[model samples]
Target chain A: MRHYEDIAVGERVELGSYTVTKAEIREFAEQYDPQPIHVDEAAARESVYGGLIASGWHTAAVCMRLLSEGFLNETASMGSPGLDELRWLAPVRPGDTLSASVEILDTRPSESREDRGYVKNRLVGRNQEGDDVISWEATNIIGRRP
Target chain B: MRHYEDIAVGERVELGSYTVTKAEIREFAEQYDPQPIHVDEAAARESVYGGLIASGWHTAAVCMRLLSEGFLNETASMGSPGLDELRWLAPVRPGDTLSASVEILDTRPSESREDRGYVKNRLVGRNQEGDDVISWEATNIIGRRP
Candidate 1:
């Protein structure tokens, strides 16, 4: 598992790929979002989205999945202070294939800690067409393994 | 129900405040986020967050609830293209009273369809201390009944 000591500026990681599905979107929406455009295809067709669309929250949750499978599970992450920015440029459709990439932008030791540091990472998601679907820079405090 | 024929620029909506509880945090974390720092107080005490903390996703979800109760339920909004930006500035903890405010920043109609327009909103969430916890800008495609 990677630790604070292992994170370095300029490090890059590819998080492979993910595909969006109508079932998943509908399920998530039914449980949490519950918007007409997210749940009912016919209602969505009559609505402004032009068609069924995924909830923005669902998109963010999908992003977290990528983070977990690609980085968090393999790291010494304590937790993040917060996100600096998150933008969803395009709709994540049921047929879209999304891939992710992350770059370590910076790292520093915590002022109050000798074994922990904060790392800033720029995470980006793109569709198969290479168009950026979402982007965020997150700051996480991590501990160095003794 | 709010329909598409109404809404003015500069509208400000006050979503009712909600009091966060530890049980709610734990339930949300267990089902949705489930990271150690968010789920286990003891583990969080040993981690960087220092205590059980709400997930960023949880904050966004709560924000959605406010929108539904305050604006979406009263507006003719169809859906959004997507979020322009999302920022989590602070941690929201149990016992915090979270309130949200949404301001209509801009409104414009489709050149070909005067009956339909889009609105951009700036939304901010604040805790009991009045500290901003999260902020976001989103685009919503609203309708104007002819």
Candidate 2:
């Protein structure tokens, strides 16, 4: 398992991928972002998007899943204070396979706590066509080895 | 329905609330976050949080739900290109009620497209004790009145 000290700045890692589906997008929209463009295919076709699209939040959640499966599970992740930015540059449609790349931008030991440190990462998600779908910068607090 | 022009700058609106539950937290973590502090209760108890806590992404999703239910449903929201920032200030625990307030920070007609406009909002979420738990600034593209 990787601890806080094991992370090196400027290192990049390839996270896994997820293929989005119409059902999952609709279900997620129904619960959290029930906009017409996100939920109703017919209405979406009539809207500006010309068809159904996933919520930006849904794409973010997919990125989170990739991050967890790729690295957070094997590390002493405490939690995150939050994210610096989130940009959905392209529409995510059904059948779009999304993969993520994470770059460790910075790391520092917590001044207020001895057993913990922070690692900042720039996470970028791209579609099968290599078009950028989502990007964000997040800082996670990880435990230091005793 | 609120059109793009209907959104006024500096207007603060109540965006409603959500009550976090342990079951829901674990369910979300299992699917999207899957960290020990978020999914495994026993391991979370031994972690830095001392108990289970909701994932920051989950809290952001809740905020999105509130934003949709409170305002986006009534507006001509095309979708958002991105968000400027996000911060998870405190741990959201089971039974903790989260309420959100949104302030329109800025609004302007889209320069590139005459059919749309841009609205910027600073959204803040607070727990039952009035402690801020999540906060973010988002920019939404809204359709202009035809």
Candidate 3:
């Protein structure tokens, strides 16, 4: 398993991809962000978006899924204390394929805890056209290997 | 519908609440977080947390849901450009009831767009014990009444 020591600053990793679907978008919106632009096609058409758009929360969650599957499982991850910033730069629509990429921005061992280190990662989710739909800076706590 | 002029800085509003459930936590984790501490009960018990914890993303989404139900439905919101910060200060467990509160931090007319304004709000989600589980600063674009 990759430990805190195994990661390096500026190292980039390809996280995985997910295809957004109309049904899933509506389902997610219905449960978590039931905005008309996210849940109703007709209403979305009349909104500023001019079409249904996946909730930003849904896109962010998809990025988390990709990250978990791609790296967290193989690492000594200790979860996160928080996110620094998050933005929805563009809209994600049904049938759009989104991919994630992560870059290690910085790392430092915790002074209060000897067993873990903190890593800052910049995560970006791009649409099929390579346009960024979501971007965030996440800080994760990782266990150090003995 | 409430417009940009309707919200005042420092105004606090009750967003709403949601009760966490075991099945819902697992289901959300399976789709978007899949970390052992989030998805598998036994593994979570063996982890540092000593019990299953809901994914922070799930908690954030619940906060979004509450915000939508509380105010978005009655407001001329044009969606958000981004969030300044998000933190999961405490663990959320099954059967734990969560609630949200929103305080408008700032508001200004859009410089480039006369039709809309920008609003900054601090959203906090607390558990049954009144401990904050999730908190964030959100900036939303709101339409101005004609």
Candidate 4:
């Protein structure tokens, strides 16, 4: 597993892509969001989005899945404190394949703990057409090399 | 349904509550996060949290469910543009009941659209002991009264 000292600022890692399906969108929204625009296709067609669109939270979860598969699983990742500047730039429609990536912005050792550090990164997900669908800044704790 | 003109700045609304179960926590984590601390009880017991904790995203989604049930369903909510300042203040453990609320911070008519406006608010979720677990600021589009 990659440790804190193994990662560098300015390094960009490509998280694997995910193609969102209509069934999955409805399933997620039904349990979490339950908004008409997200769950009911007939109602969504008359709404601003003109059709069913994935909930912003669902889109975020999808990005998280990709991040876990491509990056976090291979790192000495402790966990994340939180995120900032979460923006849903565009609607994610069904069948839209989203590609995600993260750029390491900074890395700092914990002032109180020598065994771990914080790594800040910018995460972005783009649709097949290259339009940004979601983006955020996240801070994660990573263990150091022993 | 409540329109943009019906909402005012500084109005605070209680968004009901939800009790998270251990099964649900692991289920959510299995699909989206799947981190050891969130998924495996044994591994989580040895981690900093000392037990399995719900994924931050899961906590956020629980908040969403409450928000949808208590607030958005009654409003002329067109959609949301985005959000900012998302913070996970504390770990959400199994069987923890979370209560959520939203305080309207500001309201403004759209500069270009006469039919809609923007409502900005702060959303907060607290555990049974009154400790904040998650909070964020969100902006939603609301339709004006005809």
Q: DockQ: which candidate is best?
A: 3
Question: Candidate 3 residues B40-102, lDDT tens each?
Answer: 889899988999999999999999999998988789989999997899899999999999999
- For candidate 3, give the DockQ: 0.89
Fnat of candidate 3 is: 0.88
Per-candidate interface DockQ score: 0.32, 0.86, 0.89, 0.80
User: C-alpha displacement of B94 in model 3, angstroms?
Assistant: 0.5
> What are the per-residue Cα lDDT tens digits for candidate 4 across B21-82?
99999999999998889998998999888999998999999999888879998998888878
Give the per-residue lDDT of model 4 (tens digit) for A1-146. Answer: 99999999999999989999999999999999998999999999999899999989999999998888789889988888888889999999999999999999999999999999999999999999999999999999999998
Q: Evaluate model 3: give its lDDT.
A: 0.94
Per-residue lDDT of candidate 2, residues A39-115 (tens digit): 99999999988999999999999999999999888888888888877999999999899999999999999999999
Q: Spell out the clash pairs found in candidate 3.
A: none
CAPRI quality level assigned to candidate 3 from its DockQ score: high
**How does the DockQ of candidate 4 come out?**
0.80
Q: Which portions of model 2 miss their true places by more than 4 Å?
A: none
Best by TM-score: 3
* lDDT by residue for model 1 (B1-146), tens: 65554666788989877777899888777655667777889988887567887877888878876886678756766666666457778888887889999998887887887767878898899998899998888887777775
Task: Give a tens-digit lDDT track for model 1, residues A1-146.
Answer: 88999888999999877788899888777755777878889988887557888887877777776776688768887766667567777877787888888899999888987888999999888888999988888888887888
Name the weakest run of 10 consecutive residues (lDDT summed) in model 3 chain B: B69-78
